[model samples]
Target: MKKLRMICLVSTFLLGLPMLHAQKKNTQVELEVQQPATGLDKSLKRKVAIARFSNETLYGKGIFYDRDHDPMAKQALDILSNKLASTGKFILLERSDLDKILDENDNSNSRFKGTGADYIIVGSITEFGRKNIGDANLISRTKTQIAEAAVSLRLIDVSTGQIIYSEEAKGEAELKSKSTLGVGASADFDISLSDKAISAAISKLVENVINNCMDRPWRAYFLTVDDGNLFVTGGKSQGLAIGQEFIVKEKGKVVKNPQTGLNMELPGKEAGRIKITFTGGDNPESEFSIVEFIQGEIDHSKLENYYIEEIKI
Candidate 1:
């Protein structure tokens, strides 16, 4: 019985070898992710240039301002500029630095003259104030006072001198003590008038700006494949770097919709992970990588499922 089984297994293996050899190998190894190129390189990361912010003030419901002027306008600008700089996505240039560049470049174009910036955020305080209202009629017989402030911001593309984004943010301050009753004795600190309060509001606005730009058309993604010392053809220019892991996927087939009778594209399947162990230093085009590990076989028949290729910078 064992001899017959062995002979049958050998015959089966011999027959399968020839059948597998008849399958043609796919030669299109490298995949392109974007179509039409979008005028921007999909493979390169997006860079930002954050310009100085303008300050403006507006009035709203609250106890009337004292003889001293509140510095909310300036406070807002400082807070927002710092917050934007911390995001690391932007190249934040201080007003002084920009002025110096303009001096060196000696250009008269107000847009860039001295600023090598991609984006510029110009903002102004529209209103700052507190108001009190008193009711004199029998129907009301009372008065109320409220404090308020508002700011308007706009982000412009310096290259095109066009506004890319604009938004208005407002904040209000409530007075706990009436000016008539507490004159000088009232709490010396007003939350709405404090730099910290203004900074917090501006921080929220800066965060909003960041979120808005996350899915922008120019956003880029990176993936690294380093198995058996696999190297990439692109580098910093291609926006790749060390310690990056890219998810591998196999392209899927096109299926037809039963009801519509239209062909629909199928989703790709995940293959494995590729980690970069090395990078091409001092040369962006000559960049290469060494593979750290591979999760699955290199030559899977499922390569048809590959899609959504990404690399890291």
Candidate 2:
């Protein structure tokens, strides 16, 4: 009887090997490939920061879902940050120090001092959970699970305190399993559907972000002027390619708002146009490029007050 029991155990183990292998293969997660930046991508390059996402869904609040340990909001933020970095279209800033940086900037007397982020992205996870959609039978039981993820994102102009863009994206993944008699197959929740759903949502968000940035004009500042060459605040990272044209304008007058008593900038007259002659450094953080006079000449005396704006072709 012992020998017969051992034989049955060995048979069961052999029969389970194929099922295990198949399950492993099906659970293999596939990540999206990063793509190279195009001309449009370079033009829209800006300094950006991602704030920790808020959890607004009932699942995150532990209402319908029992799995309270899952950090759905944090996972969404991480995925979005990765997607934005891979695009090479934005200089990403650390979120942990964002509040401190903003505070310092606010209290500083210098206008240019402190960490500068042209835009800040804030998000909220609205839905994240799994639903069991399968049925059971007398001979065989079938189990189907569908994981869903959804996020709402807002792109805010840090300097203006305005929401430039807002979008929502959702993704879903399905997993199906079946069992006959005592032998069965099932996929883990993490690998089978949850991860895929998050990735899909991130992909959609990235597309919308890129499209919105493209609609805006590119702007930069003149860092220095020497020997008739203008050192601008942008380089290849900002899409300032060789022979690109930019309009240089002297800083305009500061006008005070009557209601708020806040200072605002008036539109400045066109100083001149400059063409990119040499691009220096590849680092996006300190990107700089040299420019030569293309149309009108810049007044060297007013170089400190000049700013540059790209002229779109």
Candidate 3:
């Protein structure tokens, strides 16, 4: 009798454990769901441009396919552009936008080049194909529609004209349907599958894009300083906040490499430090900042000779 009683007690405890855990989980989920999303969070916004996204494969082309307006290429480009923008880490530009920015900058201030995309992503859809596979038995048949896509990408630094990152990725999508006695569902040629396949391929590379673009050190250039007021090329649109300190460094001389036939700039030494006082602009491409000297000073007359970097921890 005692053993049965003990068994009943153990079963009750075991059952009660799940109840306690469930109650705790419900409270935790409620707390998590109550948290709101704020769009004003401080996030890095680097300048990036989509140089080109070409479709090299013959998968979606026919006699009527226009080389200049390849739908496949356009689809891939749109997918990649949207994915990169969704991260909120880049100010995207097209080839046409570059000229407009340069012109506007030249008009606004000769010193500030405005915001040009330092990084450009070049991509190609290398391969794409779709097929239907069918399996049959005595009384039942099954069909599966499959799509496969492959893409190659290169992230280039516009200033250095160098490929900073390169990668290739592939994606696939499948849909299966089974019919018994010819009484099942059937699907037409779904173009959505191609979009999905391409999206999947680009999604795999977005992280690499963000990481390589950010790996390069952030640098702000001196635009102009007048009567103790200093202005830099970046503003709040590019993540500059008031009271943030940055170390200033003199511009290093550029030298041509004898072996590679390439011109490279030597590392600049620290000159001084400055703190941001104001950041204002109507748009990211026209942004500017006012700063006050905190430590050290640069040749204000030769603004092109100095640049700013984040203070080291």
Best by TM-score: 3
Residue 259, candidate 2: C-alpha displacement in angstroms = 12
Off by over 4 Å in 3: 1-42, 97-115
Model 1 gets an lDDT of 0.50
State every prediction's TM-score relative to the real structure. Answer: 0.41, 0.66, 0.77
Question: Which digits, one per residue and each the tens of the lDDT, describe model 1 over residues 1-33?
Answer: 999999999999999986676542222222223
Per-prediction RMSD in angstroms?
18.6, 18.8, 11.2
lDDT of 2 by residue, 184-257 (tens): 89755555476688778778888888766656666676677677676877677666676667778877887666
lDDT of 1 at 271: 60
Model 1 quality (TM-score): 0.41
Please write out the lDDT profile of model 3 over residues 1-313, one tens digit for every residue: 9999999999999999999999999999998776532222246477788867889998868889886798889999999999888888888876655434433533222222333666777799999999999999988888888889999999866655557799999999888888888888877778788998988898898898898887667667778877879989777767887777778998788877788776667889999888888888898777889988879877778998888876534
Off by over 4 Å in 1: 1-50, 57-72, 86-91, 95-114, 131-147, 175-186, 189-197, 200-204, 217-240, 243-313
- Cα lDDT, all candidates: 0.50, 0.71, 0.79
